[model samples]
Target chain A: MSYCVNCGVELEQSLGQCPLCNTPVINPREAVCNKSPFPEEKGQVEVVKRKDMSILLTTVMVSTSIVCGLLNVLVYSSRPWSLAVIGACILLWVILIPIAIYTRLSVYTSVLLDGLGTVIYLYMLTFLSESSQWFWGIGMPIAVLVTLVTEFLVVCFQMLPRSFLTNTLYSFTSLAALNIGMEILIDRYLQGTVQLGWSTIVLTVCIIVNITIITLLSRKRLRNAVRKRLHF
Target chain B: MAKREKPIPRKDWYQLDLSAIVYPTLHRHDFAPVYRQSVLLTEVVDPELLQRAVDLTMPRFPTYKVAMRKGLFWRYLEPNDRPGPFVQPDIKNPCQPMYFKGNNRYLIRFYYYRNRISLEAHHSLGDGTGCMCVLQTVTAVYLRLKGYPVETAFSKEQGYFVMNIDKQPDPEELEDAYMKYANAKFCPPRPGEKTYRIRGTKESFYTLNIIDGIMSTSAVLAVAKGYHATITEYLNAVLLYALLKKQESDRRLRLKPVKVAMPVNLRRFFPSKTLRNFITMIYPGVDPRLGEYTFEEIVTQVHNDMRYHINEKFLRGDITTNAATKRHPLIRIVTLFIKDFVIKLFYTRVQDHNSSAGLTNMGALKVPESMKPYIVRFDIYMGQPFSSRTNCAIISYEDTLTINFASSIIEADVERYFFRKLVQDGIHVKIESNREMTLEV
Candidate 1:
């Protein structure tokens, strides 16, 4: 195939010139013809898919959840409350499905589904007649801690550059800062006093150390990237 | 006849000692003010015939004969018992015959190696366009000497020179007036002051390439056909594109400003021409981040950017005017010294930040082609380089366009990439190599 000399693009048929770039074309087979390896194709049509992957995701997610649940209940259970637990789990799932499907917001609907399951389990707890005070303080704090850990970890994973120690330091500093603010609020509302403690000091130290490491790493990155970045 | 003029004393801005360092070719990137390499294609013509060529080239460049006397800069050529730069001396400095050096270590090296020829003026004198007329006239004189059918045109050009007139700067209107009136800290460089000896060759010099090309007068006109831009704009675009490609890879700079420092003819800007350095450097800068520029686009930008600076606003003696009292010659002199010397450094820095290098289009050289016996090439250098920066020049002779890239640059790749990209863009670029380039030893 021949191409345009001025703006390289393939010529059509045995035509003397390229239709696209509109320059005179010389056949590659000819002795005098000069051509570059890759022709600059202007305005040629090509495939552009809006979405690339869809079906593969659904099967993997459904299978993983089912397998994890079954293994935990059947093979790993050491206590005798298996039947009660399995029945409660099925009941919770049946109640949550309708809320998940009907709600307009993905976030709100997921929250509502979790709420329904929590309510079901709480009703079952009432039947057990355990002390309610423990639930208010211990269970609630542990639950909040777990959720915060999960969300913070996910964000740190997405934001920080792909370095294991860097991401760990980033998360540690972020969590420490978060808890310090929480501590101040808690002390103000509950104790009605300003107080400093060992944990607070430790958290502050972690914040500083993490920040220093990140700053050093950032500087190194900049130094290496200077020629690429600085025009002068 | 125009008013009779006096030969005012011209001041030297910098001094050079050539013994410390020498680069063989005009292509070296170093600043070599003392020993510049030149090639003389002597067309053994009689002095009388060469005189005729001077007549023809001058109607095109009659402006050069005027004696320049700058009111602001105070740089004018004064009468002496010697020829300037063209004087030949015996013994030690072979070029001293062609050079004129007196009390000041400042010497000029001119070429008339053979009989009659034209001296290619360095950028320090004027841009290519300004010098072309002078050169062409000189070439005509040489052709006439050689019995070539050269035109005997008496050029009516009144060279850009100011004569023996009492010209003084306007008084300055500084707001801090009396606050610092009795006391200002720094002393400016005195006129005709020379810098300290580059402490034993204070500078290292080298030239990587020196080249010349010629374009058909019609082809140059074709570049300006629709836009009405000058051929300088066209050649400037080619250099600008080469530079933009060189620096485009730098990621640190948010955006690089590509500037072409073009010297505008002050004769047209102002009615004055008798002053040396009458040409003011104007920078036409563009942000390369704009992307995918066509040669035509750069040409248009260069056209507007240059036109703006040479416009009436800057020329009306507004920014350049001073109000120093005539009675206090000291105050006036000091004020003028500060204005001329201090501001130039600032302008140079601004230009560096805004440009990769410089591209000076002197316009077309109009020498009758017959004089040089099939003119081989035409080239121009700035006579010196910036302290650390580099610059490029493009001179078109007839059918060929010669692009010269000079540097004192640390990064060799800037020139390398620029030339590579330029050749790729369809300009037939020939670099002056050490062995390949034939220069005066």
Candidate 2:
């Protein structure tokens, strides 16, 4: 018999490491046997593969798009409504391809892929509609702005130290900023002027909420009171 | 000469009891509402004989052979024709959701490894007491099949009392005792305080670490007697005390209530032999926000609470409140899908927040005297805790009381602290784990 150097508990000859501390037994006389007291097969669980799930999802999406495209062309035979189905297929591919292929892709890479996919899918829709002018003027700017704001918020959430109140504050502030940017883009595109309308009211309320949260966080008594009231 | 064989009759389906309704609805992929009970024998298990025993014993447990099906108003249990899953050498974790769609399988499974014969049953079929009855009967049948001179006279029934296998199964065994006994009065729900939950890095691959601490029943009984407490009360105090010590090291958890949900066997209080989940939970512990409490104080509080609340009247009132809610006209009219959604929401939002850990003591296991020589001991392992990281169960057979701690987390601090406390109090504990750690290193 050997003993764990760290925990000082007796170790069985079959166990190479201490069951409690994982300290390797150093005794040369007692050779560790590979067999375990419990069956080896029982220790493992059959975890469902994410890749398999992704493949199944891809199959379903492709099959639906194909069937719809075929029905549109064969049954109607007037307009190329199949193009709309094809555009949807492109969007689905863009959203699901990265998730399916690269399971361990970084968060930043995933967000960037998603943004690129959205832009490409919108471009496909514009090309099919023969509305490149509107796409360049309206759709591209909105999609770019939305993607940038989303990526920024995702980065903030991933990198920043987070608590319930702080997370809520950050999300509200980001949402308010995104709303303001979207309104400015929409106003400039629609009327050739950059003026805010309902966004200012939302922004003001968001600012007040953030300020209240900041105050509560800074004051220990107020923070405890809020926590108690919210039951967080 | 030609002989004619009798055609076997089809079995009829039965409706799920009121207490069993929540189990099927709340069961999810990660959390399967199943529990396991095992009996250790002196000799290694024979797979073929065990299968034969299961085949013979399945008919005896009529309620247990049913499969769950969704009806318009509620989920019901249908009698399944397919045989129970073969007594395989256990190759997967215990109680890992035996129920699946399109499998034509029953809710219970039998597995044997070396000297251990384990039965994992979905809680929807029956409670621990009911499962124990099936296990004891199966063991008796297996011993008899093995040509051991075992008496086949004891009747195998649903309830824990009366181990006689000669009598026919009583129809009362399948009765919804909760509905039958509950007085139709809606009592207001009691408010519950949140308890401190043990947090740790969950074990990879969703594996549970089960550590069985086998000790002498006399030693534990002596300690409990000294404190003027019952075994359950003493064990609850020790578990709480362990949690308290762990909580002290973490400043954030120091003020939380260290409550343990004790499952009270309703059969002891009510005169019912039904095998369904006839149990209620009683949360007993110390509120750490009040102040630091000694071990003695904790025991006294637990003992007092148990003595006061474990009576027939109190349990009847608790069941009545539950039954009244289920029997409410509006609730009964609601479709099963909506009811399932509400139950799932209630389970997570309300019930999960109330208790930190659960302790279920199946108490002592009994077997026919003739079959006792082949059996070494028995163990009861509650599946991983619903919301907490750890749960404990205890069952004593003969002189040995085995305390099984099943945890989803990697840290064994609570078990270590608990067993060490027992050791300090002059009780010897022999530890046996599933040995998952050996593979890790």
Instruction: Point to the candidate with the largest TM-score.
Output: 2
TM-score of chain B in each prediction: 0.57, 0.93
Lowest summed lDDT across 10 adjacent residues in model 1 chain A is found at A36-45
**Structural similarity to truth (TM-score) of each candidate:** 0.42, 0.79
lDDT, candidate 2, A1-47, per-residue tens: 67556544445456666555566778877787765545667534334
Please report, as a residue range, the 10-residue window in candidate 1 chain B with the lowest summed lDDT: B15-24
lDDT of 2 by residue, B171-254 (tens): 777778888888735564654777788878777555767777778999899999999998889999999998888788666823
In terms of docking quality, model 1 is incorrect
Q: Write the per-residue lDDT of candidate 1 for residues A1-232, one digit (tens) a residue.
A: 4434543323333344432223454565753332311122211111222121222333344555466557757887654343345436544454444443333344434444454455445444543444654444344444455445545665667665756447767678767755665565456545767475755887978878787666656697754565356535
RMSD of 2: 5.4
Question: What's chain A's TM-score in each predicted model?
Answer: 0.40, 0.74
Q: Candidate 1: which stretches are off by over 4 Å?
A: A1-232, B1-77, B83-107, B112-134, B144-203, B206-208, B211-230, B250-254, B268-275, B289-300, B303-354, B368-377, B397-400, B409-441
Q: Pick the candidate with the highest DockQ.
A: 2
